[model samples]
Target: MHQNTRQRLINNFPRSSAQHLPNTSNANGSSNLRRVGYIEYDMSRMLGESVKTFVYVGYVVEKSLESIVDKKKVAVKKIVCGSAEDCQKNLQEVKILLNCDEHENIVKYYKTETDQDFNVYIAMELCLGTLQQWMEGNIPTIQPENVNPVQLLKQTTKGVAYLHGKRDAIIHRDLKPDNILLKLVGGKVCVKIADFGISRVLPHERTSLTIKTYSGTRGWKSPEILNAHSSPPGNLRAHPRMTRATDIFSLGCVFYYVLSGGRHPFDQNGNSPNPELRDPNILRDRKNTKIEHFSPRIGGYIRLLEQMIDKAPQQRPSAAEILSSPLFWGHDKELNFLVHISNLMQENKSPVIQWCKNQIEEDHSNNEDEFLPGLELNNVGWMNRTCEALDFYFMYESPRTYDEFLTKDLIRAIRNMGTHYETLSPSVKASVGSLPGKFMAFWNNRFPFLVQTVWNVCKVLITDPDFDSVLMFYQTG
Candidate 1:
């Protein structure tokens, strides 16, 4: 909203803009998202310890129609890359983030730009330090050499909820303490979720792949995900199907570290009281014992965490289910207290959202679909066509037709999805419910052509978009 930021949005918009695509609409066609002017705020600042040309980024400033760098005032994401794959991966992550939009707690993206030398830069809010730093500090010193397990689980729940209910169910594949940034904003703890570049979308097909290389730190991979068959590990394995449960495993590792005062579950040098990690399955057998004996604040939460990091892909919890779990109930009062304070502050500031405030009087007079509540043509037909680059990703290879857009890779994704859905625990299946209605609908409709060779496709479901509801009031007038 600053002056320079305003100017940036105007200057940065792609020239000779294409016709705006229509979004899903109910009666009056109001669900469509309009392009807006915005500024790209300065999200870069030199880090004191980092030497990899890494800059602490600030959020993008999308005010009206521009991209401008802001002064080093607000927190942002740190942008770094080592290759072309990293560059492509960065943009892919951005596209996913754009679809996700904003949540009160999720880190924000104001503007993105490419450098003079062709390197891409993502500008966004930066956090002060990771949770690992804090745990290694006074919190560990004050206690009787023990950590507050309850507080740890509560914070994790708070963050996971923001990703789940708050921001369209994003799965943070690597949930270790080092990635959890703990900051002091206005004297209150403002936990900002970071490192989405390595973060894979579990149910959503995000994260581009080139080589079947191992990603994420060694200690964090799930048993199934860890390419351990070869010496030095991960040398000769077929690329594994990424599932929603992969993140659950990573979260378990995170929970283990947080509850145990920054000590890694897979300790290498054997410097702590804990036993050494021989294999990834150590988490599976030791989950209940460790939670019962070690943690104070997060004592009971570990059982819930075990459900997430299950050794089997089918055993883990989806991000959505984790939020609704009884284990996170203690976190409820804290979240509500904060939401109440937020509501009171907002009540003092403004009114409820009126997205179609500019609705025309005459436009309300013309709508044949007013009789139908949730039915409407999804002008967002481009969901499939627009993302043809990921054609095989939706229903990738196998018995599928070689000619169709949704290739073998995508068909595999669809297959993995059905397999995961059917095999998941009841709680997790309930959690995976109705997340990708439009995309699935688009994929399912394409099957006779796209997946003709493939048989036994999963059942499809698509929900009425909220955008359609907005159009109703205006079109029915």
Candidate 2:
């Protein structure tokens, strides 16, 4: 430890209290110190360190009749503030954590204390380790079976959504794997998003803010933030401003990292054989890179990531929009959506049906063979196919029209599955419920354009008062 840090620790805990605890030094050269407080931290067991803070492994200690017993373990983040502005910045993180601690996917905040020297000590729920450490193989106790990459992404997305949905929308300017912690909750691995030191909370009525200084890590940063500091004064507005969408881009990168088993999409060539040119090479690649490295097995998640990391900030989906994606939906939810769409297809007078038909016609006219090849228009119009059509489109290699899939394939699957769902075994139901990947695969392979097409139509329908109840059913049900 630095002399100043050691001196500060000694000053914070007086000599009288220090004598009660054991004094020891570890192989790594960190020495132990005793402190007097409701929560006691083992100064020797440092968890991590940043430029402004040091995190130590701590425990809630209480005195019993027999001896002193440690009740619960926690993490103590000691932030050193040199000036008033630095202290306020450190306090902002505590304030944000306190406000958002109710969420399961967010790190839980306990209590905070300050020393006479203006140093802030925050006690928070301790996690096994960081996602970065786990990804790098530093955490041996957590095996592959204990961690679910998709679940981790879903939980993190939920936390982000909660923050963005606050009255004063909070933008987590810095979101990277290092800031994401992992904990064992009820024998299963859970994700907890941490580190709000650089987060920004927008005022009511304000959606975005323009900051003079740059924030966020390179490679993980959205293109907007990367260019914010370099744009000319007159072109500032042209550059994307800081908003909740900024975190979406970083979340996409983190998702890529988790799925790829630690490789950064923008920095794939960062650690090449030529050591001297790595940094410059990564910088150049990020400047002009298109994401193309994700495994095809990820299915629709690839498409979702593409939308998230789009260069235009406004084009990216909101956190809530991301939660509605098929990537996060259960098989029942997906089947429900398909059945709902099938029912809408029966009502030819419905605006959703009319709009989808127009889009299908437009797509067919523009891309002919690519959109719906080998279809004989003289056979039957799409409006004629209703719930009465029992033919299965899944039996056929491909559908001749969008209505065929919606009315025939989708309806038949729902009927066949719904009728037998109760009779099926529990294991079979488990297999059936875990079908997001297969659902995405089916759509991506068969109807390549349907997902975006339907979403676009739904966006239009949401604004119509007549479709309010219909939209509510689709959203909530």
Candidate 3:
């Protein structure tokens, strides 16, 4: 840390004087010959009470042959456990934090120590504050707009994906906004997930675990978790299983809170003085899948949240799947995806083309629900009307059928957009430029089913065979 940076961090500490404590044991072997200057906070307003811990700002000082120097700054989490269970939980969090230190989005663990009173002290990288504090206007230095919610959500998803992909998969049972910490890196806001007290590490052979213990905050708990205790014992079918999807549900709520400017999807009026009254309503709404309406500004981003917070845990997308969503794609990436789909459609043997043919056949077989049956390509009136509604440039010669529209006309439009990018309408450019954020709503408004069908088909076909291999088509022609 620079001298100026060190001074700036010191200035942020409360007015109370620092208490110097000598380090007796170096259990982690991370540093040498050190004492910590622990910053004090008022116990009445301490934020770590819920987790049975006390958090403080602390500075590590190393003594050399010459002089003592302030080596590093860290957040010291002290847990005074009253029982064996509490001690085990504290150790679990410390172990998980140390294991996850390599990831940039996770808080870094420096070292751990114990005192004569059996209090566990864990020192980790100090961040500015929690995501809750930032959103609630507690952090005055950085504005909310400076931290792009989309990018923050992407980073958070990456961290969750990392945990799920581990050799022994980890499930963060308590993943709420308060557990996400924020810091400024090169004048840009970066998120760091913290406080894994209730996290569980799954066995190598298992993907999920069923536990009876109730964990996680009320408003953000998944439907399965909320129903865990309600179900009868030994009823495996009714009991909630802890899986990677559990984290995704909480993440969805956090995403909504971030995008909707602190409003929860299940509870619009989250500021109720009585959480007892508010929490049950939120839970009820979540169980019924009754989401509050998001602003039009969020556009199709809500689709991602809906899938994540699905009532059935099995229906929710995995952490890796969430990361692959078009919600995270940039303009260049979206254009590449569209171009790749267009290229695939040109080949008769292409899976994408075959998928479209299959869809047309299925729709035709079910005459009761035929989509735009007998629609002709050269129907200038219908084509113009549809194109105008979709904000698409009309073609002189259109496809003869709806299948042809998918196989030829749609592909031609995508190709033309890429080829004539310079001459396209500003709206068209913006729609493609912002990806699902703008394009999804733009097309969905005109052709809801058609747009969804094409997008889903292309999304799967473009990354064919292996759903894990996301955006592989972007690298191809």
Candidate 4:
């Protein structure tokens, strides 16, 4: 491990009973350490054998009691690296996950952990199950009355939002009946986003994050992605970079499938021109792919596809903007739930605020275990420098002044949260409630005077007159 990353792990390691405690201390005073092990194991661990250990739910990985006993509930993604591209894919995924973490309908990304070749994992929330299972088996069959247009709109938005990339082909390659999943907590349903390996980031402007080849299943490819018409002159080989429109095309297919009761929209009825529906380049046959055309009454549900499946990448609305569309107002159940949770968080101070005040006031000088994730999580120089301006205010100015700054920031966060909540719909809002307390605590202690500064930074970045698109996170389908 690099010295900087090792220290980051030590500083951010949580104090919880769920993690196993081992006798791992060394003579040196380092709070934590990573050892190089040479164990005698059979050839099975070499081939990346799939052994199903009872770990976090909705996960495809192995786990041991010692490592995960404490963080018992986190959903981790474990990928067995078998090729150079696989390793590079994991690294690129880690880079993107770390830098960009925004959006309401998208899954909350935590940290990516690398455990040599023996193991690799991406820990996130554990949701109920996939959408394919829900649509083909239970929900559509038993609860037809509960088919929610708004919730479907919002949930799919979240799926495409995560799949939103700097490059267009960075879409959900495996977008199908079975890939979508749902989990309910606190009496509200939330969309769970997953499957990173098959997915890649799409580039926005002409840049390096562009697609290298046409990957993913054949069924999900867009018209342009499926054909070689975009090939540059004098070159027989096409430019393989997938565009933003790739996902919108797949999204059109997914919605058509759901509306058709698991029927393929492209299936032929004797007179079909392209009976296979394998080539996405020809979409004229799709008018017959839908199971039943959306009526003016229900037509609204599928009508939005006119723009989403446009042949051009520039025509599709971004994931964040789509979440705010009027088409989602009445159909989705998840959107309604997010709206409620966001409103709840907007009132007064959040629970995390009280937790931080209690911790800072009571533990100011008290003795505690060395494993606490406070103090050096970020360098004191950097962490303190965030408040360099506030330092003068706190030392020379009154506490009342700092309190006012805090209140203003909290209010701003609440208002922003409201817009985000409305975009995400309620299902997403409910899921995010898990972290507000932690975020609030961190905001008050870490930033000290957040309301006054974060917006100042946001204004210069997000809304500046000279601003253009080079996103830390891309939220479009």
Candidate with the greatest TM-score versus the true structure: 3
lDDT of 2 at 227: 71
> What is the alpha-carbon lDDT of model 2 when measured against the actual structure?
0.63
Candidate number that wins on TM-score, 2 or 4: 2
TM of each candidate vs. truth? 0.48, 0.70, 0.72, 0.48
Winner on lDDT (2 vs 4):
2
Tens-digit lDDT string for candidate 2 (214-245): 77665677767777667776765665578888
Off by over 4 Å in 4: 1-69, 83-85, 100-104, 110-119, 138-147, 158-174, 202-210, 228-241, 269-276, 280-291, 300-303, 312-325, 331-477
Each model's C-alpha lDDT? 0.43, 0.63, 0.62, 0.43
Clash number for each model = 56, 0, 3, 34
Tell me which of candidates 3 and 4 scores higher on lDDT: 3
Instruction: Judge candidate 2 at residue 99 and give its lDDT.
Output: 69
Residue 128 local lDDT, model 4 = 54
Better of 3 and 4 by TM-score: 3
lDDT (C-alpha) at residue 371 in model 1: 21
Candidates arranged by lDDT, highest first: 2, 3, 4, 1
> In candidate 4, residue 101 scores what lDDT?
32
Better of 2 and 3 by lDDT: 2
The alpha-carbon RMSD values of the candidates against the true structure, listed in the order shown, are 24.8, 8.4, 8.9, 22.1
**lDDT agreement of model 4 with the native:** 0.43
Writing each residue's lDDT as its tens digit, candidate 1 over 266-367 gives 554324534335254343444333433343334424445556656676887655555444333322332232233223232433222121111211121121
